[model samples]
Target: MRDPVDKLSAMAIFARVVERGSFSAVAREMQISQPTISKVVKALETELGGKLIARSTRQLSLTDEGLRYYAECRQILAAVDAAEHSFQSGKERIAGHLRIGSSVSFGRLQIAPRLAEFLKRYPDIDIDLQLNDQNQDLIREGLDVTFRIGELNDSGLIARQIGITHRVTVAAPDYLRQHGQPQSPAELSAHNCLQFNLLNSQNLWVFENNNKRHEVRIKGSAQSNNSEAIREMVLGGLGIALSPVWLFSEDLKAGRVTAILSDYVAQSLPIHAVSPANRRQSARVKAFVDYMSQALDAAPELKPVR
Candidate 1:
């Protein structure tokens, strides 16, 4: 090992001497000769061009300059210790705040429930989860990460596909019994289709057949910006809705809602984790996203939304 002869070492030694009120005590603690500790303190005072210590046969006291230098040295030493702790290990490193944005239904039913386990694994991490159906500007909103449905637009943000989600056209048994079930995508035009107002075009529903794409622009009796609201309206026998399968998983299992358009399926979109380009480098954001990905994969209702 090399000798601790640097200026920082000298400053630290001087601070320790001041803290202990004895050069001999600091020398014994550092496993160095008392004369060597005195030499290091003298060198430190010379370099700073200040008289740092007032010494007597009984004890030592810091001069005004020494008091200021000791305070500054404590700050420097604390910063060095913090830097070391931050990179020492994963548990120590991933300690910080994480601001996450996600859609309402997905956040509550998917991400929020699984966060308990994530927090258990990273007790040092604090999560701030904001849920809304509307799109968010990650950088402008000061969000560390966000979950977005569908293909991401080209922008400064970094995006990665985390899972697959698809829409299912469903109606309550009462609603279908009253209005009659639509046999084809085009027939949906004649039905009272509930709309998710958060979508850019609530009237347009796209479908695929024979590897060809087609669209149906239909009217609706009720609409809501929130997925849960639209889901509730559908359950009340108000209208049909194209919704995420997981949102209606319980109803589907109980046979309260019936899925339609078996021949022409609604397209599946990739759910994504979007972050500011700079935030993509953050260990907290990456760890959170990775945990969310695993949790989503294990969700029985989600099932990749195929």
Candidate 2:
């Protein structure tokens, strides 16, 4: 006996729950209580006349029926979004909610600082910035776009290369003083090299010297999934690290860390703005990507090494 409008609202809530994988996340985003979110979804299941979600202590999974309904919900919601957007003028059309994702350090150093200016330009556009060290699935997380670094796998997502992350081999002054500087890429194997574990080739360091490529397998006392953690380890004089120059630009300038093996060039990772292939590119997403592309391109630090 609920109003049709209420049912639509419930459907939207149910879809949000599916996208976020939790009722709490949708509740926070919608500025509602968690119990209210659960109630709406429970009501939805009752109306549908079957169990849609399989709930457990650890995680939520969709039933077969839930999966079908979820697919249909996406199509219906997308159509509604399109219909609403069609009536707006060009500038109005560009205004909406955007969920953006990035790695912890990149989001903190690059994206977070630039958001204020982006917001000022598009006053009506609201953004949710999600930061994590692990790469999140754009479709599963319901993200409009995500900034990624390193070589991408064949994930079937669309990626636009926005910048290059020129890398350098560096170590703290005390560490170099104690362990001696490495003259060549091969010498890296003799030192305690800190590893960034998120990359597939974490222990394998690659370099180029005078058009010759060298790959060195290194071992370390410590390794971390986070770039900032690796930076901290290097700064603590624990070990040498081959990382993006931007990650230690200030430390290098301050002489807290010193660049070594300057004659050998470390492999540079590509910075990409990636989006789900299945999602239609909206004006807001396009605008944010274009803005970030221009912003990141102008940074001399992100430019390819000569």
Candidate lDDT scores, in order, read 0.80, 0.88
Which runs in model 1 stand beyond 4 Å of their true positions?
A: 1-85, 89-92, 304-306
Give me candidate 2's TM-score against the actual structure. 0.90
Q: After superposition, how far is residue 202 of candidate 1 from its true place, in Å?
A: 2.7
Worst 10 residues of 2 by lDDT: 83-92
List candidate 2 stretches off by more than 4 Å.
1-4, 56-58, 85-92, 304-306
lDDT of 1 by residue, 103-221 (tens): 98889988888889899998888988988788876644557789988667757778888888867889999988888988888999899988887666668899887888868997887
Q: What is the lDDT of residue 23 in candidate 1?
A: 81
How high is each candidate's TM-score? Answer: 0.69, 0.90
Residues 85-192, model 2: lDDT tens digits: 665554437677899999999999989989999999998799999999999978668898999999999578989998888998989999999999999989888999
The positional error of residue 63 in candidate 1, measured at the CA in angstroms, is 45
Worst 10 residues of 1 by lDDT: 76-85
RMSD of each: 15.3, 2.4
